[model samples]
Target: MPTTPRIADERHRYILEMLQEHGSCKVAELARTLAVSEMTIHRDLAHLARQNLLRKVHGGAVLRNYIELTFQDRAVQNHEAKVAVAQRAQSLVRPGTSLYLSPGSTTHEFALALIQDDLQIYTNSLPTATALARSAPQGLRVTLLGGELVVFVEALVGPATEAALADLRLTHAFIAVTGVSLEGGLTLYTEEEARVIRAVIRAARKTVLLTDASKFGQLVGPQVGHLEDVHVIVSDHIPDAYRQRCEQHDVEILLTADLDVMPTSAPGAAAADRRN
Candidate 1:
């Protein structure tokens, strides 16, 4: 049967979400959800499998060993949410402060939001360095850690990078991660990158984990650091469970992103009917 006309990119994203939410989704269900034929759903699954984003099974598709999205793809994944998180992080950034920008999609967006000058920006991400070059409204000092670049991750890691940041001091370090589990603490995929981030955290007087709502409650890969190691967490959504854990650890949680303004009618519609 022929698949209905659907945006290829959108369908892939939707399928990914469906799988994540359900843990596994059958082709028939996915087809119904997307209003496409089984053949189209199979094709979508095949493409995502090649990207290592999922594993195709007999009946349908299941999650892979990890989520291996490229930096560029992840950057646009939840763009507005990232921007809102970036703005919240900006409130903590003052002129003349030194920031250790770690490698991640959210941190890259944070780099884009940075506008102050007379500040020092240190990072290992190629995109973060490039973004700061363009958007720093004032004269800024940028430092790139010396290391062999991880092309896929678009950042520097390994011994050279760690050594370079050894003596450096930072006012703040914006840490990006794959998941946050109460038992596992802060976690990311690669051990090398995890060690580098921990070093950056040690150098900073304050550490703020910049992440989105999606990362909450996920437990994956290596444990980067303990919850108490961080001072603050800025995310789009902080669930009550997470809020309780953060409070227990003495970690401040800041929810700064307002959701999209999708009103059924004109503005102020909700307030119109509600009178005292």
Candidate 2:
């Protein structure tokens, strides 16, 4: 049987799809499957690596799965605590203001909790945007930033996203981090994310970090900025060391337990229940 020929772009897409399904791909197998030369397969893998889509191994390529777990996977970790933190963060957001919501499981919860009418929100998380579109108040506006998609994180990032945020001023920036501490400050799993989140923090009048206890003292990737960049920290629990650090920096800490008693003004709570 004669093998059908595929263009370079189509071949690249097929290689990436295979990587996503199997986690890795051998150059020989890819060449045979795509009906291309081994050298051609190698070149395709190299191009994908340049795009930061996959990592090259000795004789094959693999997806960049080691950086962080997919968004759905991380969403299940500390679920209850994330909800509590989201509920508390919802209270601090006033109606009718522009805000930036960074991509993360916790910030996805925060997007679900928002009920404020006439609010303008810019975010890179596809799930967050979809959630708001399906359940947000009629007067709310959600803008999904345009950029390169990072499959594992389920967010759009890269230079295009940074340019979109370059001019806009936000009332608040609700951010989440993989790690937070006095020494590490706000750290994330990738430099791509760090660059975008740092822009968010700079654009807003106040930056509210929505995080849970699990991320309290851990250090992961590069630091986004110093703890001083954050104006408010909403968490389910905080270690005494961090609590003291927050105090020294005059950063206001809002514990979920303390704020949980307050009635939620967001209409999306019931909707969030249904979706869950």
Highest lDDT model number: 2
Q: Could you tell me which residue pairs clash in candidate 1?
A: none
Score every model by TM-score: 0.69, 0.70
Top TM-score hit: 2
lDDT of 1 by residue, 1-276 (tens): 444445878899888786565445678988898787898889999999999887776667656767666788788877888888988878777888888999999999888877777888899999899888777777889998878877778998888888877888888889898788666577665667777988887788778889988887775545578666777788888888777766565576667743332223332233222211
Per-residue lDDT of model 2, residues 166-253, tens digit only: 8888988899998786765777767778889988876777788899999876655556887767777889888888877766666777
Residue 56 shift from truth in candidate 1, angstroms: 22
* True lDDT of residue 7, candidate 1: 84
Model 1: worst 10 consecutive residues (lDDT sum): 267-276
Clash count, predicted structure 1: 0
